[model samples]
Target: MGLLVFGGACLQGVGGLGFSMFCAPIALLLFPELVPGPLLALGCPLALLAGLREFKAIEWGTAGYTLVGRALGAALATAVLQVLSGPTLSVVFALLILGGVALSVQGWVVRVTPAASSAAGVASGLMGTITSAGAPPLAIALQDLQPAPLRATLGCVFFIGSVMSLLALAAAGKTDAHNLLIGVLLLPWMAAGFFASGPLARRMSRTGVRRVLLTLATFSALAVLAQGLLHSQA
Candidate 1:
């Protein structure tokens, strides 16, 4: 778990994506307690770190527009959580991950207008609140931006979204000391991975990094979907 968290965090530090999307599926298999709650808790600090690191590159205008959408999406997600069963939620998350991957690979040139930004934000908020895997939507939305701005703006967006998810989780009684302790325990690993990312970030092209993320995201989503199927069968 620590190693996975470290790797995911390192990737996020370098590419501004993949921390939760990579970690959450594996964590669901290995440590079921650390899914949306602990991951969201951990992501708050990790995202803030990235946002601060590239603060100058952030597209604040887009961030504001997306945040407004996130507010709406998070509210809807909170409502969804009230009635959905665990396996159902897992399946929903899996589909969302797969859908995001499909959109990314399709080469659709979506203009980042305010309307699109808010729509993407709403999607991200819903997915992030449910699965802790919101980056794909935002990543696709900002794909046309410069790599530095893309990464920085994403980090800032995630920072705020994570806070909202954590608060919602806490209100739903899904967050507790156990989840928080797990998040705290993984901090050092996350920090180590983050530092290691500096070299990798310099070496890899943005396209190459995004390709890797797409592959990992697809695999993670498939894995979770399989897990959900098995759980439902059981």
Candidate 2:
């Protein structure tokens, strides 16, 4: 597991999405029992820290508008999933991600107007709750903003939302020692990636970034598909 996390760090060093896009799938392979629930819960702290680190860069009007609907959507997903069987939920979210990928390919960009942002917040919350895979829409929406605010706002929102998610998971009694260790172990990786972000972001071309993101997303999705096909713990 530690070795897998080290791999995660290298991927993260390349781009910001590796924690979820790379680490999560590999972790899923090694620890299916932990994936959609407990392990996902532990990682919320890293997500929270990510956002909080860029708190100053958040646009109040935008974040405030977005969070309202996001909270609502998160609440909705939580309420729904509390009763659903695990397999059912997995299939549902897999379909949704397939849809998102399709949307991405179809030139259907998510606009970031006040109304759209709020709507996307709800989508983010729901999608995040469903799969812990919520960023494509928000990323596309914020792509046009200045890079600093764009990244900072994302970090802040992910952090804040993830804190709420962790609290929810804890209340549900899903945590365990292994996941705790996983989150702690990821600390150094997250720090290194965050520190290196300055130069890496500067050096990365947008086209290159998008290509990397797409490739990693495909790999992650394929990992999930493989798990489903092989009747692994999905």
Candidate 3:
């Protein structure tokens, strides 16, 4: 679990996304207790560190607009949780993630206007709240932005969204003390990953980082698809 958390956090620190996306499905398989709550708890500090590393580059205008859509989307997802079974939601979410990744890889470009930001945020919030795979929408939406700004803005958006998701999970009675404890324990590993990212991120070109990020997203989505398949079989 520590190694997984460290690897995922390293990806998050370098690409500004992938911590939970990369780690959550595996955690669900290995340590079911470290999910939704504990994993989300780990997100707060990890995102903050990643964002702060490139703090000067954050695009506040875009992030602000996205927040509004994220809130609405999260509410809608909560409603979905109430109506859908776990297997159903997992399958649906995994499909959406795969679709999002396909669109990104195809170079589908949506201009980073306020409207686009909001749309991405809504999608991200819905996905993140349910599947812990929120970054793809925002990542696709901001694919054209410079790496520093993109990473910083994404980190901020994720940091805030993580808080909101945790609160919602708590209200839904999905989070508990055990999850929190596990999340807290994982913090050290997360920190280690973040610290290790500095040299690596600095060495990689922006294009390289972007390619790596998209590849990671693709594989993460596949992982989710596998999880959904297992759930359906069960």
Candidate 4:
């Protein structure tokens, strides 16, 4: 688990949003208790570190809009979860993410307007709360930004979203002392990976970042899809 956290943190440090993407699927299969709640808790500090690393580059206006949307989406997800199965929601959102990635590849550039950001945030919140894989929507929406701003803005948005998610999980009785302790114990690994990513982040070009971002987004969607399918089968 420490190794997993370390690796995921390094990926997030370089691309601003991949810790859960990289960790959730494996953890779900092995350390099931470590996911959603504990992973979301760990994400908060990791995102904070990334945001502070490029504080000046954060888009405050976009972040604000995204947060509001995230709150609404989370609320909606909470209500929806009572009605729908998690695997069903996961499959739906995973398809949506893949569609977004496809459009992006086809030259559909999403401008960082208030509506787009907020909408992406809503999707992010819903998917994140259910699947612990929320970054894909927002990452796709902001993929056009320069690397620094992209990383910083995503970091900020994710930080707040993560906190909101933790609260939601706590209210839903998904969080507990054991999971919180797991998150706390993994902090050192997260920190180590974050610091280690500095040199690699500095060396990555804009194109490289975009490629990595898109790839990660696609991987996130696929992983969610697989998870949903497996759960449905079971």
lDDT of 4 by residue, 27-104 (tens): 988998887888889999999999999999999998999888887887789999999999999999999889988888
Which lDDT value does model 1 have at 155? 84
Q: lDDT, candidate 1, residue 180?
A: 92
Order the candidates by TM-score, highest first — what do you get?
4, 3, 1, 2
| C-alpha root-mean-square deviation, candidate 4 | 1.8
Q: Candidate order by lDDT, highest to lowest?
A: 4, 3, 1, 2
Highest lDDT against the true fold, candidate: 4
- Model 4 scores what on Cα lDDT? 0.89
Error of 3 at 229 (Å): 3.7
lDDT of 2 by residue, 1-234 (tens): 545544554444344445666667666657665464443543454455445555576676777777787898778887877897434654555555567566766766555679877876886677666666655446445444554455556556665666676677778877667766666665665556555555766677655555555566556555545544454353
Q: What lDDT does each candidate get?
A: 0.79, 0.59, 0.80, 0.89
Highest TM-score model number: 4
Q: Each candidate: RMSD to true structure?
A: 2.9, 4.1, 2.4, 1.8
User: How many times do residue backbones clash in model 2?
Assistant: 3
Q: Is 1 or 4 the stronger prediction by TM-score?
A: 4
In model 4, which regions exceed 4 Å deviation? 79-84
Q: Is candidate 2 or candidate 3 better by lDDT?
A: 3
In candidate 3 the C-alpha lDDT for residue 113 amounts to 95
TM-score of each: 0.83, 0.71, 0.87, 0.92
Considering summed lDDT, which 10 consecutive residues are worst modelled in model 3? 85-94
